[model samples]
Target: MCCALAVPLPVGTAAAIDDQQFNELKDLVTKLGQKIEKQDLRIEQLEKTHAQDAQVHAQDQKTHEQDQRKIQELQQKLEETQQAVSNVQTAAIAVPVEPLPRVPLDEATVNHNFSILGDAEFQYAKTSGQHGTFLFADFAPIFLYRGGEKVLFEAGFDFGLQNNAPNSPGATTTINLSFAQLDYLMNDYVTLVAGDMVLPLGTYSERTAGWLNKIPDDPLPRDLLPGAGVGAQLRGAVPLGESGKLINYSVWGVNGASSADGTGNADQLDLGGNVGLRSDNAVANLHGKPSGGARVGWFMPFKPHYDLELGLSGQSGEWDNAGQHLWSAGVLDASLHLGSTVEVKGEYIRSCYGSDDHGNVRPEGWWLQASYKLVGLNLDWPVINNLELVNRYDSIHDGLGTRTRRYTLGYIYYFSNTLLFEGGYEFLHSNDPTQKDQLIFQLSYGF
Candidate 1:
């Protein structure tokens, strides 16, 4: 509008313009007014667009903050989840899981769990200046039961028939429970045994039981120790090296030696007594304290049929009903095998007992036995191969000025691994008049 006003009009027409020029000037002024109105509208529209753009920018900034908050929340949640997983893993490591139940055994397995094995013996005997006679018959059976994966139950019984007296019509029948025990395999090198177990005071009680003994009769010194005891024991063998050598050990606690007549009388001492009930209505094991014993042995094998074993064993405890006297015993045992058929074994036993009349008396004995299988000679003769030569020397002292010595020569004929015929002649010398030389024959079968 100012430019239009500033426009110079014709100088002569300034005071009194013509009608045609004045109308044209009015038209130009109206057009300029319309242009100014449009300019004002454009400026208002620009301001409105700027305000809308600023509002949009502020909204975008708010959205970006919300997104940042969401990401932070997600990261925190993830961290919490990871911690929870770690805690769960730790708990799993610390806790123990229950084992699965065992499957029941089938009928066949149950039947197979039980096994029976044993031996029977028939014997004839003759003593010096005495007529020969049938001595005794023995039937022994061993029962075995598999209780579990690591458990076993075993029992042995002996039934015997013998002459009661020198011309007596009545015969004697005796029954004995040798040993009944539960064995548990505690580990690779340990076993736990309980109940009436064979005492491991020496190797003879276990190794020479029943048909395993080549001799018809026990060694004289063996009567000094109890064969079995009611007790619990821990036993095992430990491998020594790679040469098949091992060390065996046993530790036991039991009702040991006790007075037969509840007295500390030396003459009335009984090795196989102290069981069941006494005359006084007292239970067995008259002594208040149980006895303790142990055996340790080393067995070394150089080759097949070539080996040596040495063992030391002992026991000690009170014996009398009053528990005033103590009894103790020690044993040293050794055995050697040479080649396939020559074997030698021996035992030295020493014992002491406190008696009221005798104070302390010491009894000692030793025995040595040897056998040679003729098959070891590589003889082509079958008869000779089936025959084995045996010899033994045994001595004993009763610790009361009574002593005995014996020498035995014997032969064993083996029909099979489980059947044998054994015969022997003994030469005996003794301070006691009752002991004399004897002849013995035995027919033994093991199944």
Candidate 2:
């Protein structure tokens, strides 16, 4: 039991207080005491609420820490996986591409940092209702070397023989070294190239090789570009967004073309000039000048298989001594892919040759190609599952009041990853009213 003690008031104050006033004062004190009790209860409720909030905050912090740790673990695992894959790839590329007998593909004894890849092709082509010629057309060997993570070198050569006389033993054999270039990886965004480099003038000269090209005949006025040139180049790839938007670009200064330089990949100047040309390879230097060229491309890829690419290229330079062959050219290319089953490709190019004799003769051409693959459709059948249907149209306006158009319907078969065979029936329509149709067949094997 507890007891409280109170001090007594003064005798005069107690006498002055009337009974009614005393009763009112007691009631007022009782109200004040009740308010104090209510305030204390409210303070206790607030303290409980604050304690609950602290517990919730602590729980949230623990969850966030756990998530961070998981992310770090996943990052470490991904890095380890990537490093393992790189090591395996490096070990494989060090072996010779074509090793000797009894040497397992995975355990070849030879160890080299360089490897070789090549394509062998044969073709038969002729005008419709005319004589056709068969020949072993091309042997292209590509050399690849990786000097370091940031340095690379590649070179390629094409050797072919054309037989014009089927009844005779004479055949014209042609051999050309396409490119011998050294690449220095400047950074993620730029690369430097020197030596006899492939010109980045158009999409075809760089991408359409014997191993992977879809068609046998190139578009008219294919001479709009040089196959290779002596030059230095700056090229790079630009990342546009995470959704697979990208841009690629190249710019270079090279030995320009002259009137003597024929069409694209057909440089006769390299053969005739005896200026100590190594292996009869010549670098053009018309009037002691260099040509400048640039190309830019935009690309986009979508999930589950769709892609689009568009590109533009242009070059300009002096061509001859008398300004008779000042040359300028431009090319535009586009490609579309859907699920690896269908593809549409096209290129348009215009070339201007300022010849003192022929004035400015601007030759323009465009070609469109489309292909559909049955293999990707999972036809489940035996023989024709790996077949593809292709079609192409080519139109030319030669500035010389001549126009030509060719339509081709073709079929391609893939016996294996290394073997491809294609055949086409072509229709040729010319303003000359004398041109005939043709049929073409080509086979290529890759190694």
Candidate 3:
């Protein structure tokens, strides 16, 4: 169809197509206003990071509740220090305190041996001349040995049972070997001590413990000394400064105790008067000469807890065995403690036998004892807190001077530290006028 014709022309054909669609609609409204300002700045940075994660989880739950209240106040102070150590272990007197800081023993490597200690006793006696004696009486067992800084040894044995008189149907029992010693040490002030010894003479036959005696015997000058002998001794100790004082010494040489004569089968432990030398632990020497002695002491310088001990001892032997007769002795002992609640012990012993034989025989003695401690009066009463209270006075003289005056009174109760119970009452009195005024009653149980 190649032939066309047009006519009208107005405004140059609509102003050039409306100025190119108005410049593309102004670039699509400036690209949606820059994408709504980048999505409002990413929603305000995610709401400030969710409020800083809820304020750091509330400060970690308040620091885990103050560390659980400091672990419940350290478990309630460890249960009140374990109930005060269970009330000081049931209390049977001993109260000091604080003693668990160890680390001490190093006596040059300490080699030990033996190490046993024992005690047993059960006795009852009644007198008014004789007749009421129950006996199982005594059993010891001591033994200790050490060999570190130079040797040491000690031994013990004793057993007794008797009847032959009070109801005499014959009972007489025996077993004895009451001390076998040996010590060497020759250093810190020397020490020697050999064989059967134990006559250090004073403190109730060598430093206490005849069942811990709160009385049920052991006070009448303990048989005028010489209760053990077969000896050889030197003993030691001397340290007098640092305020502890101390100066102890012993000297010996023995085989000395005598006076026996009921001869026949021979082994008796006093069926009245030392017949076979009382079953013999020592006490067998009768003649040849060889009795020696000495004891010197001092301790604790007055008061560091209040204690003091003083001693003096002596002996001379040969007491009848066909070689004539001669004997001698002297001892004076003392002990005093005050802070552990009173204690005063004493002894005076003076002996002689056939002083040159003018029909010879002389005897002498003395004693005193005291005790007190009702737990120092702070008593809350655990049976008076292990009680105590004791008293004794003694005398015995004869060899022709006669005299006999005894008096004892006692009470002990301990209950632990092994165990204890004792009771006593003696009374005697005599100047002879036919003599025979007695009254005794004792009961015991050591442990």
lDDT of 3 at 185: 86
Error of 3 at 158 (Å): 40
| TM values, all candidates | 0.74, 0.68, 0.28
So what's the TM-score on candidate 2? 0.68
10 residues in a row with least lDDT, candidate 3: 263-272
Q: Which residue pairs in model 3 clash with each other?
A: none
Q: Of the candidates shown, which would achieve the greatest lDDT relative to the real structure? A: 1
Estimate every model's Cα lDDT from 0 to 1.
0.90, 0.79, 0.70
Clashing pairs in 2: 128-437, 223-264
| Two-way TM-score contest, 1 vs 3, winner | 1
| Candidates sorted on TM-score, descending | 1, 2, 3
Give the Cα error of residue 196 in candidate 2, in Å. Answer: 2.1
Candidate 2, which segments miss by more than 4 Å at Cα? Answer: 1-111, 164-169, 261-284, 323-325, 432-435
Best by TM-score: 1
lDDT by residue (1-447, candidate 1, tens digit) is 989999887877765667778899999999999999999999999999999999999999999999999999999999999999999999998999888998876544665789999999998999888998885568999999987778899999999886679977987899999999999999999999999899988899999867788888889998889999888999999999899999999999888888777889887666656655677797766778988999999999999989999999999888887888888999999999998789999999999999999999999999999999999888799999999999999999979998999999999999998899999999999989999889999999999
TM-score, cand. 1 vs. native: 0.74
- Cα miss at 332, model 3 (Å)? 14
Residue 130 lDDT in candidate 3: 66
Q: For residues 351-383, what per-residue lDDT tens digits would candidate 2 score against the true structure?
A: 877654466778899989999988877877867
Residue 233 shift from truth in candidate 1, angstroms:
0.5
